[model samples]
Target chain A: MNEVMSLLKNHRSIRKYSDRPVGREQVEEIVAAAQMASSSSNVQAYSVIAVTEQAGKDKLAELCGNQGYISECPVFLVWCADLSRLKAAAERHLPAGAETYESSVENFIVATVDAALAAQNGAVAAESMGLGIVYIGGIRNRSQEVAELLSLPQLVYPVFGMCVGYPDQEPGLRPRLPLEAVLHWEGYDAERSESGVKAYDETMVKYLRERTGGMKDTPWSVLMAEKLAQPARLHMREFLQRRGFGLK
Target chain B: MNEVMSLLKNHRSIRKYSDRPVGREQVEEIVAAAQMASSSSNVQAYSVIAVTEQAGKDKLAELCGNQGYISECPVFLVWCADLSRLKAAAERHLPAGAETYESSVENFIVATVDAALAAQNGAVAAESMGLGIVYIGGIRNRSQEVAELLSLPQLVYPVFGMCVGYPDQEPGLRPRLPLEAVLHWEGYDAERSESGVKAYDETMVKYLRERTGGMKDTPWSVLMAEKLAQPARLHMREFLQRRGFGLK
Candidate 1:
């Protein structure tokens, strides 16, 4: 692997942070790099909010399922799929009779993809600078509350959050599905996935056992089974609808 | 900025590619780097189909709005939001009478986000190896046909496709929104976006005039206005539903 690939493969989500602060200049640099990520048709329908104040982070930490690292990190960034800016621009530029489809499901997907692409770039940029980062999906646990806390406008939803700071603790790299399991050639290969995942289940079994001191030796499939049987963020659909996003 | 940030910032969508072929080993390296990207709780709900055969590429190219570059590129990758693997795993591990939420809207978002994050990493890794990439959102233009062509299984849908090869043309970097326009401090700043976009409108006007030799001097916002007025891939919701993704 090359140096850039090494940086990418070395990624680990940091949940513990040192007291070192992330300078605003550093944040700006990271954001600038993120802004350059591919946007669908250059709509750039995303916005990031850097929460540095103690109270703001504290509230966000609570909102994000009380992930205290959000509070401990020097910066907690809320990555939002924002269509309001596009809506505003469309209103400004379109002829008076033009109806806008800014909130269509397709645009929603575009905005979400744009936000994720930008966030990943920012994550890589921060890692290159010795900064550690963790994505907080719990930002969506109470999406409505998070929106209220950040005073987000209609048609803008927080997709995820990232906690950035110097690493105080190192975490092991999580094993992913085998390359064959995820990468197919020419067309879909359903046969490959079954065996690859069966093998991966064994690998993950050993990993979980070692990581948890043999207390949690359940196979990865079982863990995944438990996860799948449980509903997560069921409010998401309703919340997006209320935010003026078109799903139908 | 460091080398990695420089690479990230230097990104421009490559629409044209030379005849140089991308080796299988190179694609593996890129996939390996992409596999290391963060997944939602390590669910890793995504897959990639690497289409290298000319016939396969031609079919996909037609499916993706006849983008000639899809056929010309050495490799056309279909990145998929996949829940089928997780569902299979759940079925294997769960006891009888257990229901899975694998097709929920939440899982749909997670899968889509996972696919996008991985694709971005793959793009960067490829770029590091002196390759170029262009994301094809048109993969969803005729998503059902695309899915049929790839023989995609239930709960597996192509989020986007990417063309990868050596650049045959030098496209100037498209200017992005001002950093302040996308970055807010502590909360969403609606006021800042207005002025920032106004300034960026002027910037984009000049860029479009120069890029098209004064043939298309339209402002970025106006282009966005037209985009918003046109419904794109309205079949996405239904297609995803047919593929067993639950939006409700």
Candidate 2:
């Protein structure tokens, strides 16, 4: 593999950070790269808020499930799925008496996908600079508080948060489901996927035993099963609606 | 900028492809890179279908609103937001009578975000090796037929398609919204975003006029307003629910 491929395949989320500061210029460059990701019809319905201050980071860290790295990391970027700009654009330029702009599930998907794509680009750029990062989905645990803290307007919601800094700890790459499990040819193959999962369960059981010194050895299926049975962020639908998204 | 940042900033959708072929080895490498992208709680709730057969490509092209590049490209990849694997995992190990797994809008967002993050990584990997790519959101235009064609199981929905090959045309990089439009400090600044959009309107007007030889000289806001006012893929909500998603 080439350098880029090597870098990509070596990815491991870093939850610990060093004190080396990330300069503003680097953040700008990262955002520049992020702005270049593909958007649905150039809507580019996404925005990022970088929190570097102690109070802001502390509040964010507390809100995001008390993840200390969120405060320790030089940057905590809140990536948002934003359509407020599109609404502004529509209000400004839509022909008089034209159909009104309203957020639909389609727009919701478009904005969310756009946010993820751009954020991924930003993640890759950070890694390329020898900086490590981890995504904080706990950003959604209290979506209302996060929004209020960030002063987000209607049609704009924080999709996720990311912590970026030099690595203070080394972590092993978490294995993924085999390629056959996720990559299908022409069409999906159920049997192949089942077989892949069976094989991956064994791999995970062994990997966990080694990683956790046999303290947390369990098949991958067991963990996923537990996760699936529990409801996560149940307020997401209501919150999204409250934020003026997916109301169609 | 470094190599990766340079590449990311230089991205442009390639809608034309040369006659060169993409090998399975390259596809595996790309997928390997993709698998390394971050997933929320390591759910990795996404899958990919590679369509190389002429018939499959032709059908997908037709289904994707007749984007000729999808059929013409040497490799077309359909990326899916999948929860079926988690369902299967739940069935396999969930303490028998535990609450059954059901897809929710939260899962919907997680899966969609997972697919996009992986796809962006794959896009970057492909670009690193001297290939070009364009995302085809038109994949959602007729979700039912496309899903049937791919034999997607419940809880698996095509998020987007990507066409990859050697570039036959060198399209200029499409300028994005100014960084100031999307990047904020600590919190969102609507005033800055508005100003940025106003400045970008002038830039886009010149770009559109130049690109279209003095024709189609509308500002960015006008185009976005029209897009927002129109109903796009209105069936997405129904289609997703049918696919066993967003039903919580």
Candidate 3:
């Protein structure tokens, strides 16, 4: 494989960071790379908040379920699904008779996906520059509080966060479902998928045991079930509604 | 910038493609790169169905609002937010007393974002190999029919489709919003964002006029207002509910 392909295939999430700081020039290049990712209809419906100060990072870390890495990293970035800018642009450029659009789940999905695509590019760029990075989905646990902390406006929601710095620890690549289970030819194949899952469960049991150093012997399926069994306790649906999204 | 960063920044949606057929080896490499993308909790809750058959692509083209490119591309990949394998895995691995998990909007969001992040890598990988790609969001326009055609099971919804092949058209790098507007320092900047939007509207007006050969002289903001004024007419919300998602 080529260098770019090699960089992508050797991906791993970085949770532990060293004291070394990430320079602004590096962050700039990373964000510029993010901006270059595809946007739906050129809407570019997303914004990023970069936090470098210790106090701000501490508060954000607290809001994001006390992920200490957020505070320790040289920079913490909150990727937001943003439609507020679109609304502002509409109000400024549209004629008097032009219809004002209300946010729908569709629009929300577009923004969320746009943010994700961009954030992934940012992650790839960070890793290419030899920086460690981890995505902080826990920010969604208190989405409202995060929005308040970041002074986010209506039609904007913090979807996820990230930590970037030099790596202090080397982590092994996490195992994923086998490609057979995840790749279908032309259509979904229930029988082929069932077999794939059976083989994968066994593979995962051994893999998890090795990765956790014999501490957690749980099966992947059970863990997923436990994690997702309860409806998200956080008020994400209401939170988005309050932010003027999902109105349709 | 490094080669990866350059590869990312030079992205442009390729609509027209030559008669060149993407080899299976190339597709495998792209998918492998996609699988290397980070997943939330390593759940890896997504699948990709590859379609190269012309008849299959034709039906999918009709279902996706008659996007001719879907049928024209050498490879059309349907990326799905999948939880069915998890369901089956949970049944097999969970303890007798373990509660059964139900799909929710939260789970759907995770899968959607996961699928998007992977698809972006696939796109990047494809571009690195001298191929081109364009994402198709219109698949959601007829989600039910698509599910039926693809034989998608419950808890597995098609998030979006992608067309990949050698480029026959050289589209310019589309203009994006000014970085000042999208990148906030620690918090959202209302005044700076307002100024950025004004400047961007002017840039977009000029861009759109030139791109459309002066036939469409509309500003970006005006077009956004017009396009999103009507709520997504498709019954995606109801469709997801029927498919056993959005329970929360």
Candidate 4:
């Protein structure tokens, strides 16, 4: 396999990082790579904040569910789905005009997609440079504090954060649902796909057992059931609303 | 710059593709690269259906807003946010008295992110292999038809489609919002970013003028205003609801 393909296939989330600093030049290159990603209608409705200052990183780490690695990583980047820039632009260009555009849920979708695309590019670029990184979606767990810490404006929300550094440890590639289970041919063949799921459950069970040092392995299905059988995620909508998304 | 980085930096959305066939090996490698992307809780809740059959591609192309490139490309991939596999696994593995976890908007977000991350990896891998690709978000414009065409079940919605093949011609890297506009340092500073927008709008005006044979030479701000002033995007929520993603 080629180097890029190898990097992609061998990618594993790195939660542990070596105590080394990432230079500004590398950070600039990664952000530039992110800027190069495709944007919807070239809206580019996103922004990234590079957090290398110790105090700032510490505050962000606390805000993001106390994920210690966020502070320890050589580079911590917070990706924002920012409609604020456009809002400001509109205000300037159409002064006294009633902000005609709707900041609806669809707009959030576009921003989220744009941010995610750029972050993916950043991750790929970092990997190519022999750096390890992990995404911290828990940043959304307490969106309000994140917004406060980052001084995010209305219509600007942090989608996620990423930590980049040299790896202190190597984690195995987690097994995924079988390709057959996920890949539907002409139409979605649910029944046919389900057959593959049973086998995946078995594969995951075995994989977990090996990884977890003989602990009783949990099936992927039960874990998903546990995840959804609660109301933990209900706070997300309210959180978004409080963050000024007005997700109408 | 390395070949992969060069390819990434120079990437343009290839709306037109050649009829050259992408081999099965390349498709598998690309899918593997995609599968390597980070997933929420390691639950890879996404799947790709590679459509090589011309008739299937034609139907999908028609369903996806008559995008001619979908059929023209040697490989058309429909990326789906899938929850059915987990649903089935839960039904079979959970205790007899246990309740099934009803799919929710959170699940949809997880699935969508998973799908997008994978598709991007595939895109990067394809670019490294000297292939070109473009994302067709219009797949959502006719979600029901796409679902029917792809045989998708209740919880498996088509998020996007991708067209992949060797490029018939190279398009230049489209101009982007200036770094100041898209990169927030410590907080969201609209005033500070405005200058970047001013610069970028000038750059885009020049780019459009040069690329489109002096057709109007509209600035980025103007194009954005025209785009947001319309309510065409409101249909997305209704479409998602119809696809069984109860956004509550």
Give each prediction's DockQ, rounded to 2 decimals: 0.87, 0.82, 0.64, 0.55
Error of 4 at A154 (Å): 1.4
Question: What clash pairs does model 4 have?
Answer: A187-B150, A187-B151, A188-B150, A188-B151, A188-B152
Per-residue CA lDDT of model 1 for A1-248, tens digit only, reads 67898999999999899888789999999999899899998999999999999999999999888888988999999999999988887788886988877667788899999999999999999999999999989999999999999999999999999999999998989888889999999889999987888889899999988999999887777777889999899999999989989687
Model 2 bad stretches (over 4 Å) = none
Supply the TM-score of chain A against the true chain A for every candidate structure.
0.98, 0.97, 0.95, 0.94
Alpha-carbon deviation at A243 in model 3, angstroms: 0.8
Per-residue lDDT tens digits for candidate 2, residues B1-248, read 67888888899999999898999988888888999999998888999999999999999999999988888999999999989999998877875588864667788889999999999999999999999999999999999999999999999999999999999999887889999999999899999999999989999999988999998788998889989998888888888888888546
Query: What is candidate 2's lDDT per residue for A216-245, written digit by digit as tens?
Result: 887888888888999888888899999988
Decide which is better by TM-score, 1 or 4: 1
Model 3 lDDT tens row, B53-116: 9999999999989999999999999999888877776667665776655556567778888898
Residue A143, candidate 1: Cα error in Å is: 0.6
User: What overall lDDT goes with each candidate model?
Assistant: 0.91, 0.91, 0.84, 0.78
Query: Which residue pairs overlap in candidate 3's backbone?
Result: none
Q: How many Å off is the CA of A122 in candidate 4?
A: 0.6
Q: Against the hidden reference, what TM-scores do the models get? A: 0.98, 0.98, 0.96, 0.94
Which of the predicted structures, 3 or 4, would earn the higher TM-score when compared with the native?
Answer: 3
Per-residue CA lDDT of model 1 for B1-248, tens digit only, reads 57898899899999898878899999999999999989999988999999999999999899889899999999999999998888988788786989878767788889999999999999999999999999999999999998988999999999999999999888989999998899999999999987889889999999989989999888878888888888888888888888999786
Position A137, candidate 4: lDDT: 81
Best to worst by TM-score, what's the order?
1, 2, 3, 4
TM-score of 2: 0.98
